[model samples]
Target chain A: MPLLDLRGVTKDYKLGKTVVHALRGLDLRIEKGEIVAIMGPSGSGKSTLMHILGCLDVPTSGEASIEESQISSLSEKQLVELRGHKIGFVFQTFNLMQTLSAQQNVELPMIFQGMKKKERAQRATELLTMVGLADRVNHRPNELSGGERQRVAIARALANDPEILFADEPTGNLDSESGGTILELLKRLSTEYGKTVIIVTHDPDAAAIAERIIHLHDGRVVEEVKNA
Target chain B: MLKDFFMLAARSITHRRMRSWLTVIGVFIGITAVVALISVGLGLNKTVEQQVAGVFGVDTFVLVPKGSFGPQRHAGGSSDQYALDLEFLKSIPGVKVAAAVRQRTGFVQGPTKADGTSTQGFLPVMGLSTELVNEFESFTGKLTVQPGGRLFLPEDKDVAVLGADTAERLEAKVGDTLLIAGDANKELNLTVVGIMAPNDEEASTGSSGGFSAGMQPAQSKDTIYVPYDTMSLLWGEASDVLVTLVRTQPGADVDEVADRVEKELNARGSEVSSITYSDISDAIGTMTTTVSAFLAGIAGIALLVGAVGVMNTMFTSVLERTKEIGVMKAVGARNSHILTIFLIESGLMGFVGGVVGTLAGLGLSALASMFIGRFFGVQMAVVASPALILITLAGSFLLGAFAGLWPAWRASKLPVVDALRYE
Candidate 1:
């Protein structure tokens, strides 16, 4: 079964008396363990698609499902549980809680999962070590470099061990060297763990890491490119 | 989950130390005022009860004129011509001894050394029987005879007992002679047989009420007490009964006897009233409660203002952390979790405020007591028990939680998508 599927999904944004169509009947599917990138310029509805696929939002029409559970059919509480346990996201800004240390940030999703301290601690420590931030576990986001902070966010994203991970402009705030390292981490995550990875960005270098790139325009999939 | 939320709340509060402490200050000031006033009120209540109980014995029934409270009032011709006949009072059921205490302004002169003419100091003189004086020493007003002196027997003539201050002013030791002259200079030489030891616990309040206080200040200190026979001689001013003390038999129903005494005195055309120690104590208790409640009400107003201050701070905190709230929701925090975290934060603020206020209030009460003792010569006691502190802490915490409810609810209801996008 596909890891993520969106059929005839439409999302609309209302501004005063105007209804802004953010997405228009977008049909998409990604197989399990695949790396896909959705690329588009501003106002191309790529951001809205990212939100729907990440479970942070639902489509106004049509079915968006993760692991066979329909997003639009879930209650608020069910939605909360589904996203908390099955979906993970990385942002362009790192979005690490400034007050939390590296380890605490990683443990946050597991906390919502109702995992005990000892269990989540062990997993969080292992994830941080995997991201090469074991020594920086006690440092807050402000104390870490851009690359290190992003590494912590990646570790946090994997804390729940979701089947798929979504990156929204993941390397937008980092220098090229740091950005390359983050891309390397995402590649390692999918290749070794057999997890599906999706990247939403306008960065060609970022899309280059994906097996396939889906280009969106005016809320529709306009072109597709396969990476060799 | 609760533990996690509490830790989160703690971290958030500690992050903005100055603002949290300022919010706590608002709550603590109200708590301090309330605690200090309660402490002082309790102490004053203790002192007043002890004084009233000492002067009016539980087993004794006392009578003053109708419409008057103290025994020393309305002394002209003695309770409307019936004169509180001691023999008649002793005839009542359950009566052990009944005696009338007569107080009059007397001219007192220290030993004149054979004819050396000394100035006279007008002081109040009270007369009671020797047996009644002995009973009074044990039950009423904590009166005691100092050493090197003795109470006068019925056969003993021209003998008197001096209160502590009276003895000091007269400079008369036991056995020294003083001339006590009544109205029209009708004088007699009296030997000081005994001196009363000072009553230290209640020096000023209850002791002054029933000793012809209206005619002259009824002080336990400067009053001279003589036998009933000596007072009857004017000394000789027509047997005016100031007050009557009626002691009931041991274990007898004193209230019943008190009712009978009042009825007998009033039934034969004498206007008299009976009073017990409980009545006086209850009256003082009511006055203290009213005053304490009034002052506490003002403090409660300040506390209400403090609660509003807490709400204001929480609202600001929720607004400032809007983006943080978004991030938290993105990480899988449920609305309930967010709500609980904010509530805990505000409740912790209030609890801390209560704790600090209780300590500061105790300190303030102690300082106040010291000043009152030094400047006003009144020893003000303070009572701050552990239970009171605990109650205050809990109350303040609840106030904080209640104040934070709306803000916390707003924080919890923020949209996850918009919150993540919030700056």
Candidate 2:
């Protein structure tokens, strides 16, 4: 069975007297150890699809399964657990808390998991070391390079050792050198760690690193290609 | 969890250092006012009660010739025929000591006076038994003869012992001659026997300048004491009104004795009127309560206003941290966490305010007490009762919690996504 499955998913928003169809009749399947990049322009409903799959929002109709557990049928509490324990998220803006140091930011998700402080600290240190940010652990987000901040956000996403990693515009806020370094880390995270990684991006250069690429326009998949 | 909460609270307060300090000051004034004013009031009430109790010690009841409704009301129309006779005093059971006091108001004539060194007007002269002097001294336990001799002896009919200032005014000393004169056939050529030491209230007020200098004038300076027998002999039936004083046995219920004395005096004749020690004390208590209520009402209003200030601050905090609230909620914090954090913050503000206010109050009360002791001839101190302090702290805590309620609720009910989107 696929690690994740979505069948005829639809999301609708009511804006006063009008209705906005954010996602309509979408079907997708993702297997373990696959690196897929979802490429789209703005207003193509890709973000809505990503939000639904992350369990941050539910689809208006249809079914979603993560690790064979039907996520759309779960309660709000169960949805939280699914998001907390199984899926990790990275945002384009490098959503690192400004007040916290890089190491503290990484340890935040583990805090939600009720891990002991000593254990959480040990793991957070290890992950920052893995992301080439061992020396920047004590530095706040503003004190770090753009690539370094995104690395901290990635470390935060991995704090629970999630089964699937989701990156939204993973290299959008970086120069070529930093952006290339982040894409290399993503490739390593999928290939070496054997984790399923999905990235949503508009840059073809960034998408070229993915094992498989799905092109989307106007809320529908337009083309698919395999990376050489 | 507790540590985390405390650290968060301390850090947050420190982050807004100026605001925190200003809040602390506001709360401090409120706390101090409550503690100091109430305490001083308590202390003054205690001192007044103590003075009154000392002035008329245990087991003693006073009798006025004409009946009056309250102790404050002085009786009218002195009747010479209805005076308390010595025989009637000796007849009452359980009355170990008794005296009938006859007061006459007069002034001392200056001898060879200089200009501006006028004859001082004296406090009313109460002619009583030699035993009455002993009773007063024993009750107060501090009265001493400061200069040149003892009180008048019963047989020494033409002698008088002047108060300290009265002796200076009349220019008389022990064995020095003075004409003790009053109106309507009351006059005596008496020798000054002794000058008593100044009382506590008198000594404090004398150096503090008279009434014009925000100080009460000394009541002791113009007082004189002479034997009841001596006054009667000198005046020759001119002094007729009697103020009788009686004391019951130790451990005996005073009210019972008072009732018994009243019954006995009434049985002898309706002309004898008695006032128990309880009556004057009760009247004094009522007056103190009324005064305290008036004063505390103003302080309470100040505290209420402080609470309003706290509410305003909390409302501003809620508006300022709206985005933070959303982030916390999105991070999986429940509504209870949001509520608790804000409540704890407000309560902490109150607690700090309470501490500072308590200190401020103490300082204010001390100043007040000094002024009272200096001028009013009444000793007042800033009282620090544990109950009062606790009440003050609790009041601030309640005010903090009460003020934070709406803000906390507003924070808790914020939609997570909208809050995250708020600037």
Top candidate when judged by lDDT against the true structure: 1
**What's the residue-level lDDT of B25 in candidate 1?**
96
- Candidate 1, which segments miss by more than 4 Å at Cα? B50-127, B137-151, B154-281
CA shift of A42, model 1, Å = 1.5
Q: Which candidate leads the pack in TM-score? A: 1
* CAPRI band for model 2: incorrect
Docking class of 1: acceptable
lDDT of 1 by residue, A115-135 (tens): 899999999999999999989
In angstroms, give how far residue A123 of model 1 lies from its true place. 2.1
Best by DockQ: 1
Task: Write the residue-wise lDDT of candidate 2 on A28-88 in tens digits.
Answer: 8888989989887887777777777777677788887887778777876676677667778
Give the per-residue lDDT of model 2 (tens digit) for B52-156.
Answer: 676567787766655553653455664532455565666677777776656566554433345545354544565657766566443323345665588656577
Those runs of model 2 whose alpha carbons end farther than 4 Å from true positions after fitting are A1-5, A14-17, A30-36, A64-87, A110-116, A184-198, A205-228, B18-131, B138-149, B152-320, B350-358, B364-379, B384-398
Candidate 2 chain A: 10-residue stretch with minimal lDDT: A107-116
